[model samples]
Target: MQQHLLRSTEENLTLKTLCRKFSNGALIIHENPVRQVGGKKNAPHLKTTAYHFDVLDVDWINTESSFEADFVLVTTLNPSVSAIYHQRATLTLSNGSTYTPDFLVIKNGRPTIVEVKPHKFTVKEPWSKLFEEALSICETVNVRFEVQTELQFRVGNLHKRAEYIAFCARLEFTSEDILLAIEEVSKYTDGMTFDFFMRITGLPKILILKLVASRHLYLNDALEYEDCSMIYSSPAY
Candidate 1:
């Protein structure tokens, strides 16, 4: 993949520039935040965190709040998401104000401008109008716009499962183990329960959960992680 570096000196790069670079199949890199995250004057109420997803190929991705952190974690686990950039661009709104979206996500080769916020704030002034302008601008550039909130992240133990899988992914594992697990699951055709898979593979649960985290094994997003939870082999295998 081609790589295009956006240095801190180029923080004022336009959205159209980002779109064009992405259209040319270049990996976009912005190593700085467009706005302050959790400074005392900026967002004292929210906690800040940094995360790294190997698939994104970035050293660290920083987020201002736990909500944004969860968004990063959940999005990183998605099989379709190809890349994620935090505070990637600064856009000029129609009202002469500027806006910086929380994330720019590349999924299935399409660029999506994502804004993470609490559910209550989405309906409030300034934010509502700002999102409207952002959506309008995105439409002109042929990019999709999305608003993600706690409601979406907190659905049906999805966040809990994502957290568990991420933790397990950090534990020791190997390509051979992943391959062996996938080979075993591929035989089931209709998928199998988690407990049954563990019994058959003789691989520990951590390895199995690691597979789920890395998306080598698929699980129902709406279901809680349990012995009975169904697991399927990724089509890639």
Candidate 2:
């Protein structure tokens, strides 16, 4: 059997709970001060609300130099991820310095710390030191630590992931139609593409995309292609 790491102190306590507890108890949930360069914004700061099984409903993202928004989507779609919170956990170093991680994720009922940084900063002075400290702290708690960068999500065909998420948010999913669409689509052995399924069922494209977004329809390259062209399967059938 796979080993389970440290379970959370509370049965249903989430990382967001930790953030709230820290904020309420006056523990320094410290974050780097936002810096504006050249009197202009570096990049757009974006916030997205997750519709799936995440603990925190709203994810505030730093889209400037990091792909934090995409990471949020990735985590939301990941089955292993139970919950995710932004800038929620604080780790205090032996030197009396406190640092907040970019995300605190509950994966398979265990707490994991995720730090999202620019590739250029990964090997640099402060980030290197910070990551080391974060790793050590996580190790002490029997948790996993991960460092994320644009390389993970901004590759070719991956840039569209964030946009795809935005598009799916506009899609509609009526229960009866979605079920009928699934039942109709499952008749095909070769799997079904969104356009073909829509042509067959006369169902709207938005509802189809909604099923795909929820993973009720499974697609391997779902993130890489447009919704209409993507192929999918139903685990139910």
Candidate 3:
């Protein structure tokens, strides 16, 4: 319901100021905000959704309603994200209750607090209140805040493209392997088909995919993985 300057161009962040913002305002429940002091269950099969990212060493996902959007945020969005933590920061509201956001993302040296809730639930009662507090707290630290839902996640074409890229990112490639693959690719001045490229490079499909993930290979405008006939070198290479 409320729109914030979600992404700011300001670089006025410091270790002291960042600490002070969290210290001054909202109480961050570090140990156990949930504080479940009940009986410890044994071997419970949690029904939470799990997502794995090739870029991240650990799997961080939500079993809750925001799983889909959260998955997209980690894998599909910008590749410049330096790190991601799930439920690592807690925000204690004015009412003495605390809320743990879905994710804390550090991208391009800036922090962003992200809340993933379905769009239909955004205008509802309690979530609206919590999100407002989240916005206020995030602004105090000069960190951007975002609320993502199905609308942003369900774009047909972009979602497919992102899925392909993310899958490629997970494929393992060593530095030496990448260099050798690129050197082979460098010979194709006029560009080459997906299959032909794979054949000449003599790399596994997964490793070839990693080339695309690392931007050594560029996708044609068609954006069709199956119909992707042409692959060119990224200018960055």
Which predicted model would earn the best lDDT? 1
Better of 1 and 3 by lDDT: 1
Model 2, stretches more than 4 Å misplaced?
1-66, 157-159, 185-199, 202-206, 226-237
Backbone clash count, each prediction separately? 0, 0, 1
Candidate 1 regions off by >4 Å? 1-32, 36-40, 174-176
Cα deviation of 91 in candidate 2 (Å)? 1.2
Summarize candidate 3's per-residue lDDT along 121-187 as a digit string, tens digits: 9888888978988888778767688887756654445556656766777666788888877777677
For model 3, the local distance difference test gives 0.56
**Candidate 3 lDDT score at position 176:** 86
Q: What's the CA error at residue 116 for candidate 2, in Å?
A: 1.0
Can you rank all candidates by TM-score, best first? 1, 2, 3
Per-residue lDDT tens digits for candidate 2, residues 1-237, read 111122344534554354444453213232221222112243444432323332333333333233676776666655456656555566777787776666777787676778877789999998898898788877865667899877775666464664575467556667788789778767776776777876778877666556555656655543534445665565644
**Which 10-residue window of candidate 1 scores lowest in summed lDDT?**
1-10
Rank order (by lDDT, best first): 1, 2, 3
- The lDDT of model 2 is 0.58
Each candidate: RMSD to true structure?
A: 5.8, 8.4, 8.5
Task: Assess candidate 2 and give its TM-score to the true structure.
Answer: 0.65
